[model samples]
Target chain A: MPEAVPDQFQGFAVDKKENWNRPKLTSYDRKPINAHDVVLKNETCGLCYSDIHTVQANWSPIARDNLVVGHEIVGKVIAVGDKVTEFKIGDRVGIGAASSSCRECNRCKSDNEQYCKTQAATYNSKDVRSDGYVTQGGYSSHSIADELFCFKIPDDLPSKYASPLMCAGITVFSPLIRNLGGADAKGKNVGIIGIGGLGHLALQFANAMGANVVAFSRSSSKKQQALELGAHEFIATGEDKDWAEKYDDYFDLILNCASGVDGLNLEEYLSVLKVDKKFVSVGLPPVEEKFEVSPFTFLKQGASFGSSLLGSKAEVQQMLDIAAKHNVKPMIEEIPISEENCAKALDRCEAGDVRYRFVFTDFDKAFTA
Target chain B: MPEAVPDQFQGFAVDKKENWNRPKLTSYDRKPINAHDVVLKNETCGLCYSDIHTVQANWSPIARDNLVVGHEIVGKVIAVGDKVTEFKIGDRVGIGAASSSCRECNRCKSDNEQYCKTQAATYNSKDVRSDGYVTQGGYSSHSIADELFCFKIPDDLPSKYASPLMCAGITVFSPLIRNLGGADAKGKNVGIIGIGGLGHLALQFANAMGANVVAFSRSSSKKQQALELGAHEFIATGEDKDWAEKYDDYFDLILNCASGVDGLNLEEYLSVLKVDKKFVSVGLPPVEEKFEVSPFTFLKQGASFGSSLLGSKAEVQQMLDIAAKHNVKPMIEEIPISEENCAKALDRCEAGDVRYRFVFTDFDKAFTA
Candidate 1:
């Protein structure tokens, strides 16, 4: 071996020093690639609410010390093991929320790797095959992952825009494409509720698939942005009192991306569903948030309520290809990857200040500094 | 004009006696048929729970005194106007729960006629075309309906069995056939909950369509009957403590037909759904019965929950043709269309005492008495 690898690199970590907790840059140890794995020099990563949840210890379990958190990773395959075949050195690549899965399980075999019982998260999770080394995330400079779980990012899509697609884009894209019959066949009207990270991408994908895209947001601030993002109509639920009433039983499908509201009049959203319409929920709100609807909501109207996880690798690739074909680039805000910007971006997202999505750039310092 | 075509016919009406309510034979006026309508001589009509609700004035908002409350009407076209082309004077036919719709609406144009805002029920509902009379059902000797709403029942199927196909059979058959990609598709694991009227026919239809049919009921008493009706396995929920647990997340499709529980553990049923599985509710138990489920129940597994009404006129005919081709027949308990048997059958249906469905067979008395 060469000289010993350093025990620290510049990365973001929550400030435990103050009474009002916040995250700041710090040095952290990085793991080396195993014989069957590859190391990605992450160029950019998206700042999802999921990352905020991790640092803030909100809906998810409390983050342990040095639990570097980011999943929507876009990078270059700087190193690969001897066993890798599909990926090699200098290949543009991406990694989503899922880091590893037992390929032998049924869910994994069927391309639903996200649902595999033994699947590992890219952050705050234990690697499945590695010998007790916990999985770090894309927030760090170098992320060592099994070759099977890493994805090849397309050349046409930029790293910053590509980062959010790995998580927010794919989360919405999977259900919209899968539920409504994918890239080829366009079905009826598709409603994208909440003009947040996922919703913005969903409008693009739905419009890309030749569907009538309708955007629903609480504020009028995003109306023009949403329409410019290929939405056919923008309904501000906050500004418009009779939005739900006027559009009762109107949409064929509704993608709900908003999080954390108790007794959300899910029934009201359901009211705009025509017979045999499907209401899909991909957002995970509070664990204690309950959804209640009258059986007549289902029985009288013949509507469906469902949920889905992130897209499979194949599906993600398909979505990327479709995005390329339709020129469906997600609207994004890129921030320099630094300790100060990390907390600021999280605060922006938490306060509903993001126009759509925020992606962090310049991961060179995260690895080598 | 042939003595102005006598409006009233000898019919039965509920009367208040000294101590009890009684059905008395009396003259009842028939609703006039519009230009777009056809009049049918009821040959056989199937008794249903809604009819009982109407007769007892129990579910009052849905009930009306003058409404002849039987929607499962298998009849012969006795009269057709110049506009009626789908049916002729001698054709055998059936009319389901829906009688009229605003044909100009998007729903009606798309063949989703039942969900039209201006939809009229066969009984206890206002007419869309005429607005001159309340639509009466098949309990009377003669019934009038817009020809567009009537379905052509196959000649080979017995009228008694074909009558319930209008309501009970189509309610279950529509979802099964639609979701399974029809009866000819392969190896779909289908579960029919509640082996009463709807479940029995669903079991037959699902099995006949080359699917593995599992019958779910509360008691073992229906096991032999269910198996004889072509169920592959009988799951008596009460007898088998591990029924839901053992078969958790196993079924591809579950048709829930049982009603009246305040809050059924729908999430438990959802847990029994395979990936991308659908749990469709066909029976409308009661309006007050709420459906409770956690968003996590839907989100984590990506399962679907919904309901479907009776099949369309075209779908109904297709189901009838499929039933005839497969030699599938409903196990119905035939009751005469007299005051005594009608009341008794209704009571038995309400008490969960009927084997499957009760078809009212004696229509000659309504024709002449």
Candidate 2:
């Protein structure tokens, strides 16, 4: 271990008293990395919709008190434990949603570790090996991860573009890869619903994946942006009353990225799916939000509706590699990782204000002296 | 054309005035077979739940004023039109749910004519080519069909067993074959919900298809019956409240054959499906029946809920072939296809009184000498 490695680091956290909606900046002690763990000097971390869910106490109770929330992290390995061989100091690495999964489990062995029973996320989750400390994410200068979960960021991918790829990039790409049986998804009709952080990247990934990408938004305002993001065509459901019927049996896959589909005619959205096709939704609306579906909808086209979690470690690596190869530049607005800026970013995210995604940078000023 | 084949055939018919509940015996003039059509001398027609639906007007409004309802028809081919090369006189033939589909459509070309837009059932529908007259079914002594839809019953499968296979057998087998990627479905955990006509046959086909079969009924009384029908295990959902949790992520495919899912805890049934698995409902409960689905249910297992129509011509033959290879015998109660007997059978089916299925026989005594 390097003596220069700081004993303490600054992080933006949420405690029981100062909850998710209003998180606070607090200094936390750096833990000793295990033989399998690597300590990273995080250069960029993305502010995702899931971060808002943590701040707002959306799904489950916060996995830890004073949890620093950010899963889309890109960094340089500052220190590696004695047993670590894959990475060394100054090696650029990245960690997505999953920090650790029970590698011995069947899911992990099958490369589906994202659904592992005892899986732990980067934030708001307890580390699989340690019981004393809850996992904290990359809303800090330094982040620690088990080497198995940390992916080597290819040199071609910039820190800014690579950060959001951890979440939005992987979420969209996993389903396409799963449905098409691999990343060689040629001649597939990929319909992306909503054009936010996840949706914009979905369009780009689907395009680069050799699929014909179509963008669907509530309003026509994002039409130009969607086409610019590699969507071959754009359809605004709000603008076209008969859009669903018109494009019936058109798409082989529909990746829904919109939040809160409470009033959305989900079956109608499903109309675009061809026979035996998949309509996968990765967006996490309120856990209680109802998605109305009729048996007729499923019977008519012999289609399926599915929900996907974040990508597995292998998938994350593949998505990043693909992004790097295809020059998949996500439209991201960079902000300094500060209490005031994070608070403003959280507020803006809830208001659907970001162009695509918000990447928190300048970690040196935010944490390290 | 055989002059011995009478132009007038007696059948239990429903008119606009008499309605579904009060079908009466009526004699109707049979039309001449077209170039690619065959005339069947109906020997036995299975009284299916779909027959009840048609006779009782359970689904859509009757497509015919004088509808003679019976789709699960097993009989001898009496006459064939000029272009019909497949069948000669006395060849055993069967007509499943769909009797005709637009032969030129993509669905027909791909052996998915069951989903063809212009497909028509054997009864309660207007014929595709002969639109003026109603397409009467095998409740009469004779029924005519487009050669494209009629399948030759293999000599090994008995007429009694083969009758129900046209409807219930194919309904259940289609989804399993579809999900499993074909009829050679070995080692898959196949769940059959409801132990009636379709469910029992599903159990047999799944077992014969080399799958581990699990039968789900409302009561424990069906346990022995299910085992007798080749089920590896039986679950009485009514008796076991915790069955869903106990068998969570259990089945790769669930064939729901129950007439109604109105009161069933559908989520529990869905919980039994594994990741990327499927739960297919083939029963047409009611047009107004509403299904409540939680997005979490779909999200958790990455499973699908779908409804299936009757099998296509190819699937029906495949199902019968599988059945013949396995000596799959359906527990059927034979009844005469007289007006009074047909009425009694419909009521019994509604009351869930049949052992598994009822094949209406004595077509000669009921129709003509």
Please, what is the TM-score per model? 0.89, 0.93
- Per-prediction share of native contacts kept: 0.78, 0.44
Q: Best candidate per lDDT, number?
A: 2
What is residue B322's positional error in candidate 1, in angstroms? 1.6
For candidate 1, give the lDDT of residue B16: 28
**TM-score of model 1 (CA atoms):** 0.89
Model 2, span B146-239: residue lDDT tens = 8888889988777877888888888888888998778877878888888888888888888888899999988898899899898999898888
Tens digits of per-residue lDDT for model 2 on A1-369? 543667776789878624565667887876667777888888999988988877677767776657788988999888888888899988999888877776776667877777766777788787887766677888987888887788888887889888998888888888889887788778888899989989999988899988888899889999999999899988998899988777866788888888767767777866667777777888878677766555666776777777777777788888878887888988989999888888888889989999989999999887753
**Best of the candidates, TM-score:** 2
DockQ for the candidate 1 complex? 0.54
